[model samples]
Target chain A: MNHPPTTATLLALLATLACNVDRKQDDVPATDPPTPHVALLTSGPVSDAGWHAGAYEGLQLIGDSLGFEVSHQQTRTPAEFDEAFISYAEDGYGLIFGHGFEYQDAASRAGEQYPDVTFVVSGGSRPSANVVPLLFHLNEASYLAGMAAGAVTAAGIVGMVGGVEIPTAKGTFVAFEAGVKAVRADAAVLETFTGDWYDPSAAKEAAAAQLRQGADVLIHNLDAASFGFFQAVREAREGGSEAWAFGMNRDQNDVAPDVIVGSAVINIPAMFLRTATAWRDGTLGGVAEYAGLRVGAVEFVPNPAQEGVIPPEALARIDEARQAIIAGELEVPRIEYLEPEDDDPPSP
Target chain B: MNRTLTPVLTATAALAATLAVAAALLALGGHSPGAVFAALLRGAFGTWDRFFSFTLVRATPLLLTGLAVALAFKARVWNIGAEGQLHAGALAGVAVAILLPVHSPLLVLPATLAAAAAAGALWAAVPAAMKTRMGVGEVITTLLMNFVAVFLAQFLVQGPLQEPRGVFNQTDEIPLAARLPALLPDTRLHLGFLLGIVIAVALWLYLTRTPGGFRLRAVGASPRAAEVSGRFRAGPVVWLAFLTSGAIAGLAGWIQVAGVTHRMYEGLSPGWGYTAIAVALLARLNPLAVVVTAIVFGALSAGGGAMQREAGVPEVWVRGIEALVILAVLTVDRSWQVLAGGGSRD
Candidate 1:
């Protein structure tokens, strides 16, 4: 009968004891200031071996090359976003990267509060004095990969499997369709979005449906679901149909080497390194940082083992287009999500 | 005298044993257990700011939902649809807050929260009716309703309730008038925490002091006995538990949006409805104890993030440790009941 009250008291007492222990530990002051700390916050686990993993790699690259202390926290909820940002900033982290577009609002709020800390968000739309959006023009690389798909497809049909119909994902498909038409004016392109980023079964089902409709070359912008897309294409090949797949996000060319013609790669580690170095030199501007074919951050990397998979003529054309994009001669189509800024508005 | 002391000692031993196992596991993973535990404590209770801003804010939702679960379980209603009820409430709350034209705080806040509670009650009403009228098992129906609620939320956010920009898969922020007022200045803690505490005390009083509460508890203890001895049908009590539980859970969802996020988005709950089951069980279905248990869980959640940041432990491992703690506590509670010569309370 009295157990519940006693148990509650005991639990409360234990919590208090733990708090006192933490306070005692905090009493000891730091003898020396630690090195400049850089932190990364991701919404998903880094073990996904794709988008999140790439960001984690970039964090490690900054730590290894720039000699900065590094930390990473996989935040699960939006409520944790502000907490993580404040915690890192309070601990003297000079630069903190919120690794997805969802971090944009939180980063904007945190940036205003912690003016000294530089907050970078990938695929972010909002940009403030300290909140820089790391926009990746992966559509440019997707266009090149589309050109390769158009060349490699003997069936005169290509497919694009994507996760989510967001502007960014749709932009890649738009550029990819244009790329295919650029190479083959009459080529039929198929596109499907599974509405989920990590459902391999849905991606595979979409891939299979595309393959059934005579798409021999396929490209996918999915995370863990890309495995299902690749599996579908491999199954098509295994069934004695000529099939090939292109990888998206990071250098996934090695993932399905036997069937992969190339991969539209994002050099995330290099971008993180450059961003960190810029932050150190005080050259990281408030404007959204654009990294694309021009900056060598985005590329269409053809598989080394499948050197001759793409027609030789198509390879030359891809190289030409790459150079044109880098030289600002050819424009790859994209959806602009960032609003135009009027002036350097002062902070409220 | 010895019996009262034995249960306390057993609970303490179980907790110590769980910590030892957790420490050993951390050491095996090449992390200093002391540093990790210290980091967790500092993250959760390191300062008043951290506790109020992070831990309490995180606990608000869990506290409400835990109370909801406890209330339902107390009446032996077996209502497992709190998750769906939460989603339904959130969607309804957001709809009212955004669409309602009255900009006054008095009109909008209460109306929005009332709509949320009604929507939640309506959601649970489906399963409650099924169980009462059709003699269907509520376990399956309630659980399945969760999926329906989630999908409905997704559709609404993507379609009807999508922001005017139509770029992100979320609703526009609720107006300032509809937002929960801040309870603590300069902290994210909002009126929701106080609301939860108030609801807990009210629920505790209702469950212990009211005649209706006695009838509900009697039916929960033994429906046949209640029918014969208490002379009351259990059906009405079950319905009451279902609607009340759903209403509280619904409040948890909308309060989270009003107080913390200020915007409705997909994945807002982070499985808090499901975790409420653990919270309710850990509290032994006591309304007041649920408040304490919810904070403990909130600390674990807040500290789990720190374990990743400061301790360098991965999230998967932190979750494993959380599961271990829950298991240990339940096991100890079960053993205490057995030692007390109480054969199956359920």
Candidate 2:
């Protein structure tokens, strides 16, 4: 913006350098804006307004506070993953957050290729020499959400709907079921995989199926599908039945204001800043590290506006479970599928 | 000179005007339109490899779908179900690849390809039959069938065809034996590109030289006049045209799956069917011309991401440029039609 007239002026300079004789028409290098050189490549756009939004918000926060240049490239396929990384690296970007688990393989190759730059993948497994997997131990929060869901279910029947069955995604569900069992011995917990990250319709169908089977409380481990789960409970309550819903990934009680009881909140921006600062300090890579309950990175946020919906005894149990997990007494279930560990032994 | 320059100049002016409007919109929104354009060009053609890679990758499906639309349009038959037909082809190709026990690429490749083409032909035949026998609109029937094709792919991926271990809504990767060999070492361009070229050349010869193709063109020009001549049956020619067009588009989808993604996911197409309509029309339904047009569009899409990455433009704005290009072409077509119609009327 400060250099619009300088574009035409640069054309004049290029002409002057060519020699004073025949005035020639050069292909005008006059088409684009002068932008600083920092870029990030992601597998999907944040326009999705849900799972990807919190990550985008963290990126924006970095832009505002850190005074660093920022740009995002949305890729559609796994094939483009490496290409996007190479593109950002070749363009001389300082830091890049790959924003998804799919970027692990590409980030490894990129880390080796562009050793000068730092690369981060949101839920990646093995951090190469230059790449770091900023693993958010949301299962700590998920365990708390399960306590809430378990406490509210009078029928002893609660349901969990998950969006892709990846290990990181599955960890939340595994921990949630564990938390439910700890609270109540004879509870019936049904889990379903809608098999999509953004299918609201499928999520709604899974919610309805759970509801029909007499599930009064529901928790969703979905990205965009949480809307459908919340809608199912809201619709149920409208039809004169008492129903409660819980959220995942980010604090999503705001999504369905009246219907949501609480959300398992993960402070992505805190993790992002910590990871970036660690990378700057030369202490970021090697081994898959995690930020759990200790760093206040992951926690459950109950809707303060609606306190009576979740029984006080249940909240107390949730608090107890949270304390137990933080104190290292409860080993939250997680899918260990990724490595620099040569063997990918089958999970039970 | 008059004929060539007239159309070219008309196209260029129309494109420039639409791009100007698009730029103004971007600028008014407080974004750098110039940066977006530069990033697009740099992303698409910044280097020799990038240009060729974008052109080749984008051209693969466009080549097949362009041929499909051109073939049917030549016979004056509207087969608007290439999208659906393509999915049907992918469904068969994926099924055959996953089910077949054969190890060698030589055997599995041809079998899967044949299955895909046959499935596409079968999908197209339903609408072709309706149009020929029941006097139904092929456009509506083909359009309606796309949902069935899309949802059928979804259902199979989620239910019976699902990879039992993974709970994601995606199919198992096709066997390595069914995959196409890459055309280039670094780029994703595959054997389908060469095949697309060969098919385009064959179509060009058939449309211009062969008696059957001439009759189809005659029908397209004036179906009533072709009937009055009493030399050929428009019904069978139209039916065959529709089915074959669908089969080619289906082949396109199958190749995209095996050659590129290696797995099937929903939204496999970012509206490749509709993109084929533009590809066919821009070349004036000429098979040879379609090659160039498809590459241009491929550049636009392939370059769009670069705009987002390097230039800081949003995906929506990158898509706006594509819409502008299409609108420019359409406006040119409409003006040409109006001018020609007006002159003939006079």
Candidate 3:
């Protein structure tokens, strides 16, 4: 809006000048430069207790462990992606971590321009020399969550609501299906993609659809949409049903603790600490890092509160499944639309 | 009769007053206002590439959005749905680009653009229908429809039209054949900017020299006066204006999609519809003038990222600066209008 248009430009201009000078200072070759700063960018609010919140936690960990001066901002557009990266690069920040794959292209371009600066995009393709795609291998935990869900579901039906069709997210769902069938050969699994990470309405609708289809246990990979899926579970249980929901992406049991049986969680803070350590020691660049369960990146925790809700045999089966997965004797089936052949449930 | 001096002088006086207030606020915060202004100038126009790319790229959406609002306002219609219209247009463009074997950039690009315009126009027609046929106030209806449109876009990408494998809810990258070539060889600025200027000029000519344009203005001034002239129906004129605005706004959406994003996402616009209101009003609903004001808004937006990157300032500060500027511009503009008393000021 050109609302008092002149006043805004002039004021913004003043700040822009102070910033650009810092950029120029960063560009000059010096024997010693100041300690490098890092910036974190997220597409959604940090309080959502899922995708964004996990990323924010990683950022905070980086600050605490590495002592890197950090900055963060929530962005609302693809255009802001380029702007934020360029600004960080020009200002001579040593590294910038964009917390989503959506920032891959922007980070790639900015990385090319700023050679001294390293750019990391979580869940993005490795696009350039200084850009590294840091992906989470969540199948390890999803498989674990699937075991818990399979044991607890009385009707032998489990549901999944996925957000968007990305490879990593698909991989987790695939492994999860394997876990479900590991306990019961005839277990029926239903999966639907809501095509968005943040649409609560669509997520709720998908959850309701699965419930009506007789799936007593539900899980979702959507970021903000997790709220809706959990809400549906809470309502179903509150209305005198024995249904449950598993939280995905982050540990969100606190979001609906009473009905949440367990959560498939990614240790994002650990990942960030590892990456920052690598960058600080100059051992990171050019390659994509895939962190899975063995490296302490993914895990599944059975809800202590829901321990008595399952029968002794079911609980025993879950324990067996967990041991097999941990001991490398079980391979969870992966759900990837990109690879249709990945349908066979892994042996637990 | 003496128009030139009043506009230029009043505009200058207004700018100074707003600056004083902003500077005072900055000083109170123990920050040097002068340093911030200087940084913005360097960031926005300091380097030619920055001006060519960041400033122009930001301006592209604003120019189209401003023109859309100006055209509607001139015909006595209020359009508060450009963001929704833009999303509709982008979605249509994406659907067509993905579905068809659009192999050639020349043919595919135009077809995609046309699809966007049509989608936008159709979306606009709903509110127009309510106002023209059912005696509904378009302001509320148009605003309300925006939420529905945004959620619909979200659904289409996440459910029906999602890319395979379902990790993220964004559409696939539009075919290379459907992409817009950069306006400059090296910069991110695309030809959509040139297109926006052309439309602005065309609308200016239509409003000033064409009879239909005159009738719309008459209606905007007073519908009874337009009815007495009997040259055209205010209903159709406003409907055309509303739909045309939607089409243009839709085109803006595709411009961002084709030229910048290269794909569709949830947030295709950051309240471009609302920003357009300020752009159109600042230009006094003059299409040609809107182009210039939109650019100013664009520069400010473009500078926001620079502020964070360069000065170690937070993103919140850049947003705060934008809000302050908007208030200053509105205050100065309103007071200037009162002072000018219907006089044309530069």
Candidate 4:
């Protein structure tokens, strides 16, 4: 009896077809003599001016400081993640930064294939021998920002707008909520997750919803969506309302100098350079790199334009909390979203 | 021989033209064209492991979606909502995977797939009913439904179907029982690829051998002529095409989730549904041909990543090259027809 070709046979034929083509070996050496090549893969465009921009700057900083050949690509989907990792590793890129938690799975897979290449994922949930999660503990700074929001809210109401309630984002809000309550015990807090990372309209609508509920101070953990939050707050103040916003992730105070009180920032460039240095020195990887206020990586930077807007006591208390957090006297709230394999559902 | 060779010749012309144009662009952008091309080829098929794991694994969904689009276009039904139908199926399949009481792989897998297909068909039925009853166009209806489906998926991941912790907007992974087994011993390629091939072969046989398929094609070629000459009803045939296309697309969604992703998340597709149109059209709406065309697209996508990684080419440029190739394909195919016409006249 004649049988049709099975998938196994067909796949074999496809590979054979590919194999038949004459191939040229890569003549370019994997790494140049003096410096190793580095790359960054972002899920969003670098022009996003938030998450992706910060990473792009880090890539540039690494290149400028280390004299390495640096490049950046805005990858859209998970399928591209493996390809980017494998390609970079094959080309002798010593370090590749996938600037989001989403890169963890693909990074680990590629890390296994190329043992020498170091893959660093920002806000990543997992860590491997070669794949290291560069955890930016911004929640500690958000806690301080929450204290500032609590101190300055004229209406005694504050709002927290977020993009996708991932554990990292949630941890910031959780710490912020705790910090707000600590400063103003009677302050009413409102929370909304826009369920997006880059939708400005949705973020604007969410901020507006919180403003309409009488939130005089707003803070957000959105990426490019942060623009909408600031816009909504600025419009609220222009419309004769007493509303202000704190910027989250990177120093976004200059983005909206008039309305932004302060920024809870993660100094991503410094972290990338430090990580790259460690890799160069053969002392990086195999564990999570927790960058927080202690390492001078995360901090709450006050807006220069609105210098005196925060009362002296609030600023002093914020400084105190910062010291306490660094000294282990104050413990900020955090969420361990990363799971071990066994935590997943059991096999049938 | 002349008839069979025409498509091959046109395809070859399209590929060559695309490469020439792309090489110029790459050179203009300060990249070595030879290096980039070599990187692209190696990325797609450099190793047996890459071919099965990267190329074929990526091709699986494209093949299924291409077949769906080809089947519908064969009957002159424009189903832009394959994206929405796919999402509908994924949502339903995941819901069943999580909520169903059955534990056996045999029972659970089939039931989940059935639910996905039904959900996909139901999603398509909305546009089909609107087109048949109100005489509204299916193109706009189907396209609009995609947005609704995406929003619905977003809501499900965030709200009711969310993972227990509720930290992120994604569903929990389905049980091991529901997952499609790996086709290769140590590769990521799964049973879904085989399923896609089987479906393509079956569809080709149905389109060529079945009476219903003939009636559908007749309606597509000319509805009025079909009704007068062949005594075929266009309405039923169109509805059949719409629903069947939706069913196939829905299965694609489920297979992707069950075979690869193992969970439902936003942006799981990365616009595979929209890409299927080009895949189908490039194959001239032939199901068997879609299999080949889909693999070509799959290789392009897989290679695009490698180009970015190996040649330091930006992803946007790789995407630009891909679009250029598709454009070249359509143009060359059209020009080949004119050339053939000139040859016939001579």
Q: Which digits, one per residue and each the tens of the lDDT, describe model 2 over residues B131-190?
A: 989999988999898889999998887777776555545687677778888787766577
Task: Give the candidate order by descending DockQ.
Answer: 1, 3, 2, 4
Better of 3 and 4 by TM-score: 4
Ranking under lDDT, best-scoring first? 1, 4, 3, 2
What's the true lDDT of residue B52 in model 3? Answer: 75
- Sort the candidates on TM-score, descending order: 1, 4, 2, 3
TM-score for all predictions? 0.95, 0.85, 0.81, 0.89
After superposition on all C-alphas, the RMSD of every candidate to the true structure, in Å, is: 3.1, 6.5, 6.3, 5.6
Q: Native-vs-model 1 lDDT?
A: 0.87
TM-score (chain B only), all candidates: 0.95, 0.93, 0.94, 0.96
Q: Fnat per model, in the order given?
A: 0.44, 0.28, 0.25, 0.33
Docking class of 1: acceptable
**What DockQ does each candidate score versus the true complex, computed on alpha carbons?**
0.38, 0.25, 0.26, 0.24
The lowest-lDDT stretch of 10 consecutive residues in candidate 1 chain A is: A339-348
Candidate 2 per-residue lDDT, tens place, A1-348, comes to: 112243344345434433321222133333232533345566566776665777777777766766666778777765466667767776667678888776765677677778887888888866766777878788888888887878888888888898877777888888888777778778999899887778888999999899889988888888877777788888888988788888887888778878888988888767766666665567877666587887788889998767788889888888887888888887788666455632322110
Classify candidate 2 by CAPRI docking class. acceptable
Give the lowest summed-lDDT range of ten residues in model 4 chain A: A1-10
lDDT of 1 by residue, B195-314 (tens): 999999999889889999888889888878898875789889999999999999999999988888878888888899899998887777778888888888888888888888888999
Quantify how close model 2 is to the true structure by its C-alpha RMSD in Å: 6.5
Candidate 2 residue pairs in clash (backbone atoms < 3 Å): A31-B34, A32-B34, A32-B35, A33-B35, A195-B169
Per-residue lDDT, model 1, residue A6, is 44
Top of the candidates by TM-score: 1
